[model samples]
Target: MAEMILTRELFRHMCEEQEKLDTHIYRTRETKAPSLKSLDIAYTNEANEAIKELQKDWKWWTLKERNRERFIKEVADCFHFVASMANQTRTVGYCYAAIDHEYQKVSRISRECYPHEDIFYKAVKGTVQESIASLIAISEALGATTDEIMTAFEDSLKKNYGRMATGY
Candidate 1:
C-alpha cells in the first residue's frame, strides 16, 4: 500500500473534535452567535497574538527573544479558530490551489492575474482548507513544522475538554 499524507478520516476526526470545543466555547448565558464576522475577527486576533510572540526575537536591541515552542502554539491557536469556522467536510484534496494562494499573497504573482504564473500543488483544497494551508505556509516560513502543530493542537483540544468538564 502507498503511504498517505493525510487521510480524510484524520481530517474528519479533527473537525469533530473542534466542533465539540467550539460548542463549549461559543455557548453563552443568553444565546450563541457564531457569525462569520465573529470567527474572522477571532482568527485575526489569534494570528496577531502569534506574531507578537515572534516580535520578541525581532527586536534587535532588546534581550527578549522568541520562544519557539510558545510561538508555534500561538500559531496553533489560529489553526483552532480556522477549524471552527463553519466546519465543512467537502474537501480533503491536495492544497495546490491553497498553496498557490499563499504564495501569491507573499510573492505578488498569481495565475489568476497572469497566464504564465508560478505555481505548485500536491493537493486541492477549499476556502477554509486554503486558510489552513496558508497557516502551514506561515508555519514553515517561521521554522515550524506540521508535527509541532499536530502536538499543539491536540494539547489545546485536551485542555479545552478539561475546561468543558469544569463547567467553563
Candidate 2:
C-alpha cells in the first residue's frame, strides 16, 4: 500500500467548498434556517446520531439489522457540518495541524516505548488510536478504498466550488 499524503491546503480548500454547498443547499430547500450556529447544532446532532448507531446496549435491538449504510451516511453528514464549522472560523488549518501533530505522536510512540510516565501523552495516544478506529469503522461500513474516499472528497470540492454562494 502507498502512504497517504494529506495537506492542510487541500483540507482547507475542501472545507471552503463544502461550506459553499451547505449554504446553497439550505437556501434552496428553505426547510431549515442555516447559519454557522445552526451548523454547529447540526454537527452536534449528527455526532449524537452516530453514537446512537454505534450503541450496543438495549437500544441496539431496535436499530436496523444492517446499519452500515446509515452509519456511513451519518458520518458523512458529520463531516459536512465539520467542514462548514471549520470554514466559518478559518480554522481548518488548525484542525489539520492538530491531526498532523497527533499522527506524528502516534508514529513516534509506535517506534518507541509508550509514555507510561506522562498521563497527557498516554491520553493523546489513546485518542489517536480511538480516532483511527472510528475512521476504520467508517471505511469498513462504506466498503471504501482510500482512493475512492479521496476521489469523492475531491469531487465534493469541485461540486462545492461550482455551487452558488447560497448553495443553489
Candidate 3:
C-alpha cells in the first residue's frame, strides 16, 4: 500500500485519536446516559467531555500541570470538535478562505496601530460578532465604507467555502 502523505488527513486522524481519549476521560468521570447519537450530538458530547475533564483537573492545578498529555489532548479535542463540526455542516472548505479574509481585515487594523502588537492581536482574536464591530471601527479609522468591507468579507467567504468533500 502507498504511504499516506502527512497532510490534513494525518491531522484528522490525530484528532480522532484525541476524541477517543476524550471519551475515555469522560466515561471515567461521568455517569450520565448519552442522549444524542447524531454526528452533531457526538461532537458536542466529546467536546463537553474534554471541557469537563479540563475543569476537573483545573480544580487541582497541580494535577493539570503534571499531566502534559492531558493538556495536549484537551487542545486536540477542541480542534477535533471544530473540524468535525465544520465537516458535518459542509463549512470546512470555506474556513481557510474565511480565515484569510479575517486576517486581511486584522492586518489592515494592525498597520494602523503599528508597533502596538497587543492591539493587533486583540483585533485578530475578536469573536464573530466582535469582528463585525471591529470592521466598523476599521472602516471609520480608514474612512472606507462598511458596505465595501462587508462585501469583501462575503465575497472571500463564498469563493473559499465552495463545496468540496474532504473524506477522512
lDDT of each: 0.52, 0.50, 0.38
The predicted structure with the larger TM-score, 2 or 3, is: 2
- Among all windows of ten consecutive residues in candidate 2, which has the lowest summed lDDT? 115-124
lDDT string for model 2 (6-79, tens) is 34555566577686676766676665435777776666666556545544421435654535445545555555
**Candidate 1 structure lDDT:** 0.52
Report the C-alpha lDDT of model 1 over 1-168, residue by residue, as the tens digit: 211222344445666678777666667333474676777777776665665565543344666676667767776676666666636332323333443444445332221322111211210122444444444544555555446667787897888778767877
Runs with alpha carbons beyond 4 Å of true place in candidate 2? 1-10, 23-37, 56-66, 100-144, 148-168
Against the hidden reference, what TM-scores do the models get?
A: 0.62, 0.50, 0.29
Tens-digit lDDT string for candidate 3 (1-168): 111111234334433543453354356556433332453454444334433433432344444432333323432333444444444445644543453455455545534663233332333345432232232233334343434433343342333233211211
Which prediction has the highest lDDT against the true structure? 1
Q: Show the lowest summed lDDT stretch of 10 residues, model 3.
A: 159-168
Off by over 4 Å in 1: 1-12, 24-33, 57-61, 86-100, 103-135
Error of 2 at 9 (Å): 6.7
True lDDT of residue 40, candidate 1: 71
